[model samples]
Target: MSTRLIIMRHANSRPESDTGLDHDRPLNEQGLAEASQMSQALIDRDWMPDTALISSSKRTQETFALMMDVPCEIRPEIYLAGLDTLLPIATGIEEGKTTLMLGHNPGCEMLIATLCGTYHPISTATCALFTKDGPHWVLESVLRPEALDRFKRVPYEVE
Candidate 1:
């Protein structure tokens, strides 16, 4: 049985405008639009997850809310989690199940590199899909905002 992982960075956050705490910063207009677009793209590909592990930060929550309609575990540790904090989640995945892990950068990027043995840029709203066969993880696809625009099935209009 193979386990699939969808690791992603939260969408664009609002510009610092007195959002005293970094954890409280919400998604901007563009972020909301991009999140909606990305959500539709995943749906079109039938890539919805059975479970989602998401950071407790406001932006991550908002991003998750905009994406797939799935059950998610709010992991406070994922907010600034390093590889150590993330590895356990990936390793603990049950066989033949899919999990979406939404988190912050540097760590998300590092996790992808460590698991797949390659470096890929993890910009905001970037989602990389990986599948584990036996003990080795292989990257399946990467969906960035630009890529979403090109692959989206439905036209998303920013409101």
Candidate 2:
């Protein structure tokens, strides 16, 4: 079995002025809804992770809380972490175990590019799912809040 990696960027957060510190900014109302929707999307796809590596920032914490009820590690080092810092953590996951890493971007975006050799924008509340393929990682799916409604089947309207 291959290992699955879910790289997610934290949901939309309040401005730094509101919290007086970037680390303390919490998710806004829209973020709450986005997080909830994404949570259901993950459950519907049966992609609930076994373990979650989350950033210690308030927004990231709130995002995860609204998403999954799984084992998690809150890492202070993950705040605004770069690809170099994140790569080792992601690569260290045991084979056959799915792990979710919730952090800020450009680190998340950089990690996805380095692993998949393709760049995919990871906006607020965006999730990039990857699966190990032999010695390499392949991009499996990307879920964004704006595109979630596209999955629904709408009845055709009679002209």
Q: Which prediction has the highest TM-score against the true structure? A: 2
Q: Candidate 2 has which clashing residue pairs, if any?
A: none
lDDT of 2 by residue, 51-145 (tens): 99999999999999999899999999899999889999989887898899999999999998999887888889888888998889888888888
Model 2 quality (TM-score): 0.92
Model 1 lowest lDDT segment of ten: 150-159
Superposition error at 148 for model 2 (Å): 0.7
| Stretches of model 2 off by over 4 angstroms after superposition | 17-19, 150-159
Q: Which stretch of 10 consecutive residues in model 2 shows the poorest summed lDDT?
A: 150-159
Clashing pairs in 1: none
Per-residue error at 146 for model 1, in Å? Answer: 1.3
lDDT of 2 at 34: 83
For each candidate in turn, the TM-score is 0.90, 0.92
Compared with the true structure, what per-residue lDDT tens digits does model 1 show for residues 1-159?
Answer: 468898989999986636688999999998998888888777776778889999999999999998878888999999989999998887787779889999998999999988988888888887888888778988888887875565344422212
Listed per model in order, the count of residue pairs whose N, CA or C atoms clash below 3 Å is: 0, 0
